[model samples]
Target: MKTGAGIREHGATVIVAALSTLFASTLILGTGVMTAALDPDLIESSGTFRMVLLMVSAVFIVIALYVGAIVTANTFATIIAGRTRTIALLRLVGASSRKVRSRVAGEGLLMGALGAGIGWVLAELLILAAVTWGPGLGWLPAGREYPRFDPLTVGAVGVVALTTWAAAWAGSRRVGSVSPIAATGAAVELRPDAARGRTARTVWSIILIILGAVFLTLGLLLGMLTPLALLVAFFGGLLSFTGIALGAHIIMPPILRLTGTLLGQGPTGRLAAANAVRFPERSARSTIGLVIGVTLVTMFAVALETYGSMTQIAFESDPALAAALAETLAITTAVFTGLVGFSAIIAAVGMVNTLSLSVLQRTRELGLLRALGFTGGQVRRMVIAESCQMTLAALGFGLLLGVFYGWVAAQSLLGSQAGFAPPTIPWLVVSGIVVFGFILAVSAAVAPARRAIRVSPVAALAVD
Candidate 1:
């Protein structure tokens, strides 16, 4: 029953589990492909193939592990939040806190195993289909054979399964914090303390930004690929990403207000802004996914644009070479950016879950609005407003981080090479992402808004 409830209610979260497994499977497949292509040459040269294989596998493992950990952690947090009522009931019925936590963990284990298995199967099926139709589909070189299975597939499943368990175990502790009668009593939204949130964000943001600045300064000053410079450049990039994420929340409310003021001028727009800020936690949480995805995508886009411009300027005497370099770079950048763009899938799923959960939490409030003669359209508009506010917050911060990170990457990697023109940003991709973010924001609200507007005011009030 517990497993079924989780699967039924938290379908979006489950998709994360599956995607984790898929990524892992892809990693395994990737190494296997490399092994097939590289083994014969390495063997002829008298090099040890096993070590090379291990190195390749290790890189993919780290990437898959990182992706799995974050996805599962965020997902399980959502699941735990939504299950507050059921957990409270379990506790009230003499279930020990340990027992409650164990149950949640067990449920997560079941979910993890299921998702891993399903993802592995789906990935294998995709591989098979790709192999069979790859030539026609243009996924591979013409007449190339399908990739063979690798032994590491089992390990990939294990990796994702373990990640899910760890995330679930960590997030389930929240179950113990809620009172047994949490649902019976008035709903006490568990929010991080606002002052502390702001203060911590501010301090951390400044620290990271400074750290990143130091790295850039040192890299620019020393202008070498030494250990210190590499460390500075790498850490600078990481620190900038971290700082932006932390500081985003601090700046969110103001950005949201500005976005709301600019985009929404009517009564509905005002209501949307008011509703969004009213629940600071929800609004803030909803933006996390968009921020990361948009940031990475925009960051790469900017870096490529800058590089292309530099090449063009450097080779202006030979327009053919300049155009060729720019075209090649554009294609390469698009491919790389597309890979990173997968981060948005998590954001979209989180947005939908957040919005749905929000709707569920405010059933009676929405009904009250309807009862007070506010039309259903008005309620819908309010939800749309909330989405817009979150979207705006995401874009403001995402673009900011993208610009800084992209410039840092360009300078760090290409700065030593003389005769390159200054960095140039292509705003077109950023503009598209804004529209994409907006659409994602609005689309996420559809089902939730429908659920909210359908509840009759009198019925909702009575039930509450």
Candidate 2:
């Protein structure tokens, strides 16, 4: 790669690392605040709401961490592979694959460590904001104390950074195996043995899906609402994600191609269109994370909306119940919303990771175009465009699903006799979700795009 190209790619890598750090840190800080808020005396008399919120928020954090790690790792792997020809050329010219791998790993580690630090600071701010927002909304009980900074948050963030770095290294392991021939423009090797496992996977996936459906149905039917039921819901949702991803693997390509024909023309549009059908597993994995977030958020949204009205009615039924019910309801609602947001954040993180990975995998293809005269900026734009397309498409579908689920939940909780239209969708809420999704998607694409820009045309062309 030329000096200019190398600079561009490195820049993209930096951006990606920075964005990941910001999100991960914020996620941790929020978790801490949510944890403190779970205290009954601090938030309310009944801590159930706070407890639920904390659990949900924790789930969100977990999702975010998982997605972030995957994306970071994939980005490195792809860059190495994308520059396969380059790596191979170097190898052909006596550059060791081990050296190439180590350099990439070191770069990834640097980013992870730095990002983790920034994330910790951001997390602190998020926690404070959450606490302030909660009490301002009359959600907290009187005299409930606000949250403060803790060493644990910093410690946790550090751990996350290290873990992500390790994961990135793991993802980049394939660099050592890239044939010098690959750098010389040879096609990547395919593994028939891995492909052979698909049939068994499909069958097992189907079974899990059935099992998940059963659990979800039973949990809903028995009205036996408990943490256990929530766990069941989590499992059900997870299995469903895997099933859907598998299904999409088999189903999306033809559909995406057909959709692309209807959508328009150009590499950007075509790429977007093609992507919808390509890599069904990755796309599905991304969607699955979002689905979990949507499910949790939607469930709480419906539940709290119903709970508020019910509590108000109970207050009217007996003035004595007013203060207690209101206090309980307020705290619960606040916690629920906060937690659901956390879940959504988690989903967003997952999407970001998947998108990043997607870009990284195409490093070689991207490099070839650069070799053919595409600018770094163009490569970057392509990566961003792809990420945006996926995110927006998923968001549109997810929102529709969320609305439908919300409506059903409202009906069930309110009962048929309770005549009322569903609550209006607040612009703030809609805007927040959309904005959040867009930002995360863009952030996810940044690193891979940067990496693509840095490839030397000669190296890219000679990649083997």
Candidate 3:
């Protein structure tokens, strides 16, 4: 029965998973090719460079998978919300919630496998093309041949598939809360009160945040002795960020309300603000991806800037060492930025998918609004306003988190060498982030707004 929904419904999920795997595999293979081209004998002479390359590739792959998982989980959650009535009917007909959830998760596993397979094939073909013709085209060194296949590619595919399956299972958790009695009512999302009542999640979120703070502080103190303190800070950042994601519904509404005021008190603006606050879970899911992307970009920028400041102070007496440090910082910044771009793309796709699904599910409500004398332009403005509001809130929150995390990272890593220093704000990156948010807000809203306004009042009202 679920398969009858057709591939179009799951296209977003597949695209996200496929892109993620493709990026990971490409990085792994590309890194090997580049290493070979640059230093074919380095592996035989010294394993240190090889290990560094491997670690760099691993960092990129991990980031890609993390972004993919969050996007996948959010997509599945939105899909399940739309299937509330159908799921309730199954429960009414004697299907246990666990059984239903398992089925959904099984579907996710199949989809993940399909996406991973497609990505693997594409990655291989891409590398083959690059290896065969890159040297001839001067894209590679003139006298070197690069290996087109890596056994690691297979591992990348498997990892992505498993991650997607896990995300799907986590997303389908809401299935357990759907009572059989709900089958008799019109399809609807969880109400604000119900969303707020998840006591266990709230408790866990607070616990993680507190523990993460302690670890981050400890990482700073321990950093005075060894650079390995970064490992501790890394876990702290992960735990705290996960807590933030888990508690987004509780954390985002007030920010949304505050940002909504910037949209003015016009009717369309008010409607948009109300809609966002009315569905805290949906709003949080929609904006969390953007938050992550913005946060990473800001964190890296601030961290690198702070590191540069500390290094300049520490190495002022050694011109050659300072010059080399500057070059290394430039290369590191470029690499991290490129890797973060993949995450941003994934986040953008998720936002578009979420917005479109929200509109689809609210068809009846849209129709009622149209019938009550709202113009199509007004509807469009309302959606765009909502998008802008969410983006604004995410931007503000991400900047704060980014600066704090970035400062912690730099201080933890370099406190012993140069002592504590103030975080250097990268105004350029912040400006770029603001501009990107504006563009994203408008672009993400276009299709969803168009769909919302196209709903025929009479026909939409007749839908269940």
Candidate 4:
């Protein structure tokens, strides 16, 4: 009767799902209302202003979709992996594979409904907070009234709910594929075959790369900085980032081990490194969301800087309009960048889930290390090293991809109008994110490390 309770036990997935939906839905509703308030007819009368607004809105939506999909899929996958035992138990007790899939889907649908509702409420509160406090904080211009509740909000919630359900369903596909025998083994047969076809994956990666390049090239052909052109460019960048991410997954095993080697001087590093690549699929799940998020972050940061500099040069004669335009663009840039960055928070949540499970799964191994005279401090360091290696590797690759995309955006958008603004590196912000990321990585390990530490070495070694 209660076989489906495994997913329910993990509140983290539910929470992340809710937040993902809320972030996207709220932005959608807010934008629609705001746009409705600013009649398109009037904005259309102004040449590029409407385009700028539309392009910004489109960017937010794209980030939301990308981040939401990755985050939701990872979260649900974590839930299913953790519940492999329950699934196997159900199978042994006569539950059909179809039934197992149904249970998982049902859980997803329930969570989706609940998450969407909560997201809607959160979005409402966010909009309310903005309306009440935005002007006071100088984030909103004076006399811009908050738009009233729009029916589109409901549609936004529905869209997110559907997205959550799809992600959950997709995540659970392998759940039913596991044989009842695996329940005793504490491992899911993630490696489906004795060997995988490298050719198929390679071909897929190549196709995506070509597709992304086409999008980017098309963006350039569309126009410079126009709404249509930037929208096209954003998609191009997104596709390219996705292609790179897939390629990264294929190479992560080597990269992780190499980075792990650099993380420290001895056996500890090797252990941590081996743990990372021990399950490349698992590691990929943990990092892909952040990879996408950070790549977008870098791309937009450079694009905005380039765009702002061009605006300065283009409108040098009229200081008033120039100042107003510059100010508006800056605000828009910060906001969209923030929206894109939210993807990383979800990734961080995935890290928490993944690392916690890693610790739980390795209880016996950690105990043996402790029994071998490894101090509690050393135990802590080992986990911390693993976290750092993962975080740094993900961010490093993301940074390079972002830089490349940002450069492309700046050149295509501003190249003809003005010579490319020297690559606008938002060093302070990037540095801040790196610091925050390390702190988060360290934080994720604390609970697991403490849990691992509390058990007597004998008991830990005895844990099944």
Candidate 5:
């Protein structure tokens, strides 16, 4: 079947899923090939090394899948919000919400399968090219053999497809709430009061946060005994973050208001700020993906810096051991930063997509403003202001989360050997993040601002 703009808008979701699958497949297949090429004696003797490899690959796969699922779910939720009119109309024609939701989930499954296939093919080509050329380039041993296929890689594809389907189903929950009467009116978004009315969600979020805090404390206390404390801390971070995400509508508005103030009190700035807070859910959805991305990057940087500092301090008498620790930490940090970069890219795609959809949905509002003496420049500035406000809010929240999580992780893993130490702030990385965020805000706004400015007042006002 031919696809519409709605389907096309899901390009980010597909790309995220594809990237996740590709990364996971490459990790799994690459490990297998490298192990296969090793001497049998070495392989048998290196059980600990092999186990560590497996654990690292598994951790990364989980991270990829988790990030992919969140992005996909958010994308679907945004798409469904835009389709409120269509869904209401379907309801008016007697179509059940279950059927509508099922249809959306099915589309998710198909898109996931398509993305997974693309990722698999890309992985194959990438590995093939690397393996074929690396020997000649002296990157690998000349006589080593690399396998062309691994059955384990296929599991990643299936897992991604199923996860996407589940995420879509979760995202489509809003469809059930759309009444047939909504078909007669213009599409509406959830206001602050309406958002606050989700008392059950708020309560659950609080409960999760409390539980997460407990787990984090336990992990810290246990850190003196074993590195396994990190496992507890990981679950704590995940739960707390999930709770924050669930309650973002509540958490984001204040931050948006604060950031909006930074944009000055100009008419355009006021309008932009009001628009951002007007639909709390929309603004939250727009910024949460970015929050996840920044949090991850900052977390790793802080963790590595903290680890390095503590190790150096602990081994102050042994310069050689300290130097080795520094070298190892640097290499590990580089590898992790590259891996986490994929999630950042996914978040960028999501931010751009959300901004574009927001502009498209606000056509009537933009037209009204234009008709009421707003200039094209004013309209454009308004859109840009809104985008900047969201970006600022995400950056602040993400950095805070990252630092806390990073400190907890480092302390949990190293407190026994190094004792409690202050988190080593990576000022350079933080500054770079701030600079890149500004650039991202501006770049993401350009297309949406242009689209908003191009809306003809007369035509837009006439639109349903």
Candidate 6:
């Protein structure tokens, strides 16, 4: 009974993780295919800073999604390792490792199949709807909505399923290592590896950071971003963040103290700052995904801004439509910005929760605080504060980039009108978007923080 329970638990994790990964990947891939088909020129020759930003951001979105999926798969693999004893017991009781592996793999395959089917059905429904509405709308391209299913999509789904199963199979090596006597004992403890990486890893990290910054800068400057350049920048930025985290680990204490001076923070804020600054690996991984997501969100903001500004220019030339331009631009920006921003928020929230889950799982010590008058509300508030701080920092960087890109795009469109004059921003509009994002981030943090608070004090003290 226990063995079945353990299998079921790990299996569920694998399935959920796999489904998420596949869905994200499909979106990325499908978007690319659609863009290439719809806007070949934009994908090719038009090398503007904003265009480069769009292309690079799209590529990064795909990379981040795939990387996240792999990480989830790895975690699922590790969890399966935790159940090695159960596997060994089954092996000793006349099951082959191959058979045990099959069961694990089969569970993932089943989930993958279901997820892929659902995705396909959704795609087909969308395609059908597009086809049906295409002519009546007059806004859509003729027959453009008819989405044909390619064998490649099916192959891609198969690859996702296979990759997931392979991860489980590889992790099952721990099963072979387990003693059959594990059936009578507690699960073996696997210590977290020490904070050590090789010289090669450090060198690679530095190289990647440098290269990523260069490609990202160049892509923005040249306005002609290729997929290759975006891929390099994506991986490079990821490695760079890893290096930053490692370096931060050494400097965090002093840095935290210095930052506290700037904030003039109270005890609660200070603690939050210390917690985030002190833990380099946690902070880096937690925020890295957000950085990627926010970077894309920011770039998309610039693209939409540029597009709207140009559309407004065209509208301004039309004396009859001049009055309508503001309303149209307002509506378009609202819709596009909301879509792009919400996607980033989802990614950011996921990353934040991933880190929060790890923290809550490890820090049973915090449960004692819940007993010491730290209401669940207070605890939740603290966790959210950390997320909000990181998000705001990201938002600042994004806004700066957006300003630059928006200016360049505006100049390109309204060449003569563009001068040394300072660009006027729609402050109220920008503020509304920022406020909406903050509200969403805060709302998302609530459930996880509450879960942390609810852990019993007994559980807190029991941690090693």
Q: Report lDDT (CA) for all predictions.
A: 0.67, 0.57, 0.85, 0.70, 0.85, 0.51
The digit string of per-residue lDDT tens for model 5 on 111-205 reads 88888888888888888987899789977667877877888789989998999899889878899999988876555678899999999999988
The order of the candidates by lDDT, greatest first, is 3, 5, 4, 1, 2, 6
Tens digits of per-residue lDDT for model 3, 57-118: 88877877887889888888888888888899999899999999998888787888889989
Better of 1 and 4 by lDDT: 4
lDDT of 1 at 371: 88
lDDT (Cα, tens digit) per residue for candidate 1, span 78-119: 566666676677778888877877876776677778878888
lDDT of 2 by residue, 36-86 (tens): 555555545335654564555466556555545544554454455456667
Question: What is the clash count of model 1?
Answer: 0
Rank all candidate structures by their TM-score, best first, as comma-separated numbers.
5, 3, 4, 1, 2, 6
Ranking 1 against 6 by lDDT, winner: 1
Number of backbone collisions per candidate, in order? 0, 21, 0, 0, 0, 2
TM-score, candidate 6, is 0.58
What TM value does model 5 have?
0.96
**TM agreement with the true structure for every prediction:** 0.82, 0.60, 0.95, 0.83, 0.96, 0.58
Evaluated at residue 455, the lDDT of candidate 6 is 74
Name the TM-score of candidate 2: 0.60
Every candidate's CA RMSD:
4.1, 7.3, 1.8, 4.3, 1.8, 8.5
lDDT of 3 at 417: 86
Off by over 4 Å in 3: 1-8, 40-43, 46-48
Clashing pairs in 1: none
Q: Tens digit of lDDT per residue, candidate 4, span 1-33?
A: 244434433455566667776776666556644
The 10-residue segment of model 6 with minimum total lDDT is 189-198
Model 2: lDDT to the true structure:
0.57
**Pairs of residues at least 3 apart in sequence or in different chains that clash in candidate 5:** none
